[model samples]
Target: MALFDDLFIRLTSRKVGRDRFGNTYWEARSRKDAYGRPLRRVTYAGVPEASAVPPEWWGWLHHTTDRPLPEDAPRRPWQKEHRPNMTGTREAWRPPGHDAAGGRRQPSPGDYEAWTPGR
Candidate 1:
């Protein structure tokens, strides 16, 4: 299981930094692809669930940051942190007209339609 061992080594190495969710990040010590051509790379450890990473970390992971999240990163006093989409979760929203809620109260009597599939 060298693949797993390599990942464990990379994740626990002192050169890597760990995020709040225990995700690890490390810069490629050398600028070269596996084929040995010059290239830049960053590696991530742990599940790739987007929700597991915070917004600031997400930006850094995508090369938007030359430096890791700063200690002084501005945050408004009233600002709330990002939460992942929960479309299928218990907390997910169900609009008033959705079938889950028995759909919009039946359309008014005058809204009746006679279907003519071909016409």
Candidate 2:
């Protein structure tokens, strides 16, 4: 599937921009999506996950903006660098009680007693 997309992009799309993660963005020269917007796509540098695209380019890719944020655009002081989804990776977050976090759940207070079978 990627092979076909690559061929199509090479033949018909123009390079829009690339994100910090090295993902390349492209738009079709003449093709458009069902919504009549220009066909946009991203060729991920690694995994083909949607999260790989940063918020900066997301708007442009979805046609929400005419162009992606400029390369030199100033980031807000509180803005952090974009990171791809890590749900299944080793660096993924695990809550304290999760098995991967050693399965040591906190104990609850002994407030309620179990009901007796015939009580």
Candidate 3:
């Protein structure tokens, strides 16, 4: 199935560009969306997570910009590189009291009371 899909894309789309993460973007050779824009597509380089795409490519993929930002685009000193969403991965953040981190949490400051049914 994957083989056929790859062949279909190869036959029907043209490579637009690749992101820093190695994901390749494509545009259908003969297809257009409702807006009359060439239909855009992406072939994931690895895990197929959408968040893995960088901002420039994201803008192009969504039709927000005519083209993906150039590789030489200006960057600010504080700019950070893109990182994929890690919500379920081992690298995902875990709060101090999260079971994955440890079953212990910091003590409360005692400024509040537990809710009671009659209160």
Candidate 4:
């Protein structure tokens, strides 16, 4: 974090809320911009990766909603925790047969057949 931004955030922003994944959302202390339009910002908790921010907060950050989604909003029983982008990292997904994992694919003879025009 640069000195100016650190000072600005500390002086001019207030905590709106934090999501389940630990991302923090903020709003300008003085509501509305110089042109009298709404303004807001977000301070990513860790690596500053945008993908880590939840969908609801992403919407609010982009002004899709006036209210930031409640931090502890109820979730469906089937819901899974959000995962941040792992591209270029060892933790990234490597599907079966992926070159990074191995060049060999599981044999599935019945999975495909060349089309025959004259049956």
**lDDT top scorer:** 3
Q: Candidate 3, which segments miss by more than 4 Å at Cα?
A: 116-119
- Model 2: how far is 64 from its true place, Å? 1.7
Error of 4 at 68 (Å): 1.5
* Residue 91 accuracy (lDDT) in model 4: 88
Candidates, ranked, TM-score:
3, 2, 4, 1
Pick out the ten consecutive residues of candidate 3 with the lowest summed lDDT: 1-10
Off by over 4 Å in 2: 109-119
Q: What are the candidates' C-alpha RMSDs?
A: 5.3, 2.9, 2.4, 5.1
Where's the lowest-lDDT run of ten residues in candidate 4? 33-42
What is candidate 1's lDDT per residue for 33-95, written digit by digit as tens? 566643322333454556767665666656667556853579989867756568788778887
Which residue pairs show collisions in model 1?
none
User: How far does residue 9 in candidate 4 sit from its true spot (Å)?
Assistant: 2.4
Top TM-score model: 3
C-alpha RMSD in Å of predicted model 1 compared with the true structure: 5.3
Q: Please report, in order, the local distance difference test score of every candidate based on alpha carbons.
A: 0.59, 0.85, 0.87, 0.78
The global Cα lDDT (0 to 1) of model 4 is: 0.78
TM-score of 3: 0.80
TM-score for each prediction? Answer: 0.57, 0.78, 0.80, 0.68
Candidate 1 TM-score versus the reference: 0.57
